[model samples]
Target chain A: MNDSPVLRVRNLTRRFAAGVVLKSLDLTIERGEFVALLGRSGSGKTTLLRTLAGLDEVSEGDVQVSPESTVVYQEPRLFPWKRVWHNVALGVRTPDARRRAEAALGEVELAHRLNAWPLTLSGGEAQRVALARALIREPELLLLDEPFASLDALTRTRMQGLVGDLWARHRPAVLLVTHDIDEALLLADRVLVLSEGRLEADLRVDLPRPRDDGETRFVHLRRTLRTALGVTDKQAIAA
Target chain B: MLDAVLAQGSRIGLGGNARTTTGQVAPRPRRALHLHLGSMRRLVSPLLLLAVWQAASSTGLVSAQTLASPLQIMLTARDLLNDGTLTHNLAVSLVRAGVGLGLAIVIGVSLALVAGLSRIGEDLVDAPIQMLRTIPVLALVPMFILWFGIGEMPKILLVTLGATFPIYLNLYKGIRAIDPKLLEAARTLGLTHGETVRHVILPGALPDLLVGLRFSVGISWLMLVVAEQVNANAGIGHMMMDAEDFLRTDIILVGMLVYALFGLASDQGVRLLERRLLVWRPQAHRRG
Candidate 1:
């Protein structure tokens, strides 16, 4: 992998009509790095993700990212009218597009759903198709916007495993914006907590791959992130 | 949230239906015998109503002059069929409706595309159309007759005018109602403007267009009825008008039956088209 940063945002700021959502925020994501952003609701996590995905405008400062990047949203956003394979192959230009689609779907374990309509797929299956679509682009940067947040506990855990596996294989620079502390530690190389407009915490994990929630360091980091987000131990226990 | 809901919903729907192929509307697999029996049960009331009408007419409880018996109407229909008056007039009426509806689809869809896609286009096309659509277009037949001289032109024009609004209104609304998230997805996927319109905008808007088409076709027939009543023409309405001069209620009733049959048949045709075109919508497969 290249040593250069895949994304660089220097004193980036974004404002809406109501007020400033992000003010003088600076961050950099190196190529092949995995970063998980944890933030409370309405803490401009969405605004930052949108800015990274090129879906929103920057009102101030420099924001530079690799042109070859894609996002997998919390929702699948698959076209209900399109078949699974076709949804994955959309805008893909290749002489062997069908073969590529089949291969991509195979990665997501949706090979059996090649001709199945998107609406026919269950929620987990649909999100898998969304993953296949993003991966087909062979992006340098992958932005996952809480892709498993809505899934039931079993499905969410399975999806998290799948995402980690895919990341291992592709080694794309991934920025996962999520609320789950356990999820962040399990997947990311670095954990950043965005409270208000600024990133308040940038903790690097030195743990090995497939880190367990039961591990001592994992528990310590989880408690630290919770504190950074202003959650007391008693309050966290009550919840 | 939509993903979570759809996942849960589909998981529930997938129980015992994993073997079924995609997007066909039975939430559960239906047995063939049950389907046939269900259809038969639903048909009972309509057949019973027909039987009651036929019985009242056969016993001479209702006079032929006041109201033709179903038997008399059937006999008159056979006579008209044998002599080819019914065939020729029916053929003429079909041509008018078909041609008028064809034109309406073309004009309405083009206008809707123009108005629905852009702000400038909406500004240019929507105002005049909104004003024109408010005026019950069947009321324009007299003016159309004067301008176009009560020939095929005026009749076809009336049908075209009457049929256009529903398609325009429904399709325009469909365009506006497309999920914005899908468009955002399309943009990220790198679809060009034309490609986005073709794949995303068109398919997304089609359900409404079909809804409009059903109304437009029904409106076309209504307009044709009025159009044929006005002048020297070869149509089902003209045949009915001639029967009135000779006080042939049986032939007039036959004409009315022909109109009703065609109306029902055309509506069924649109419904079939809906089933085929919108196979993606699970609701389209439901009996209701």
Candidate 2:
């Protein structure tokens, strides 16, 4: 593994027509680190992710990331005209691109759907294919833009577990932007809450692997995150 | 979603069983009625019109010289066929239509791509095409005859002019209507512009292009009918005019029927081409 950080953002400022969405933000994600960003709906989380993905330009500051980075959006965004394996192998240039794509689909447990159209896949299956597509690039940095927010509870849990497993295996530096407190707590090595376009809280999760809901540390961290997001103990308890 | 798929599966299963049960339980009279309904759906109007025509002919409601009877028309058709005049004229008209439509496809597709893919090309090519398309090609027959003389050239050119617009317009719309999101995805995936055109834009535009082809083929035949009327010596229109001069209304009816059959045949040909080319479309696989 490289000694340098996988991504470095310095004094990043993003301005929109309305006003400044992000004001001189700074963040660094080291190699193999899992960082989760929590924010309100309009708190510039997507803007930051898009910036890192090279989908948006920053008004000021510098962003340095590995060239082999890939982003997965909330919607699968797979080409509806392409089949499953073809979507995964979109940019692969090897002679065995088909085999590599099929293998990636197998990692997502969709090998049977190699030839299936993107339109026919269920929502969960589509998201899994999106994951396969991102991972097939073997990216050194993976940027996720609320990828699980659209899934149902059951599928979301399964997808969270899948992400955890894949992260353990591939060890890519991941930056996940989401609004769900539990999701951030469960998967991230460190969680940062964005409020008013700046970091509000930087909390670390020291909980053990396969952490359960019954763990006191996990609960404590959840409470801290909720408070940072302006949710009181009463609302937390109700939730 | 899985529930919906399962429900659909069960419905199809039950439908199959229900069809079998109905087939066994239905009596002979009901079966006959069903058969009769199927035939009546297609044949009723034509049979009724034929009966009316027969009554008019037998009762001398109209003279044969004015409006040929159905029997007279049929006999005339048999006579033309035996004399080989109908076959020769039909062959000539078909060749003219084929050559004209072929040229139209080439020119229309070339112009549509040049305009649809680039801003400067569109600015240069689209205005003139838009203006030309609005001037009905039939009205240009006299001009065409004067320009190209009273040979096969003017007739073929008329069909070409008539057929080109539908293809160009539909194909242009199709190229523009491709989803931008898909194009963005292709760009992010690092496909070159040429590759994108081959693998994405063309396939996406194929359905509309096929529709345009159907329209152009229809227009080609319509133009042929008119173009062949311009002092033609050997085509279907010429034969019809000759029959009219001699008061052979039966032969004129025969010519009209031949034109209708040819139009129907060309339309069917296009439909078959559409089905073969557009098999990727999901709706194309669905039965009525």
lDDT of 2 by residue, A1-239 (tens): 55899899999999989999898998999889999999998988988887887778766999998887888888888866567898898778888999999998999899999998777789999999999998888888998889998999999999999999999999999999999988898899999999888989888888888878668888888888888999898876797
Q: Which residue pairs clash within candidate 2?
A: none
Off by over 4 Å in 2: A232-239, B1-39, B285-288
Tens-digit lDDT string for candidate 1 (B231-288): 9469999999998888788999999999889989998998788778876665653533
Residue pairs with backbone overlap in model 1? A123-B7
Which portions of model 1 miss their true places by more than 4 Å?
Answer: A1-3, B1-61, B283-288
- In terms of DockQ, which candidate is strongest? 1
What are the chain A TM-scores of the candidates, in order?
A: 0.97, 0.97
DockQ value of candidate 1: 0.56
Error of 1 at B214 (Å): 1.0
Local error of candidate 1 at residue A63 (angstroms): 1.5
Q: Over the true interface residues, superposed, what is the Cα RMSD of model 2?
A: 2.6
TM-score, cand. 2: 0.84
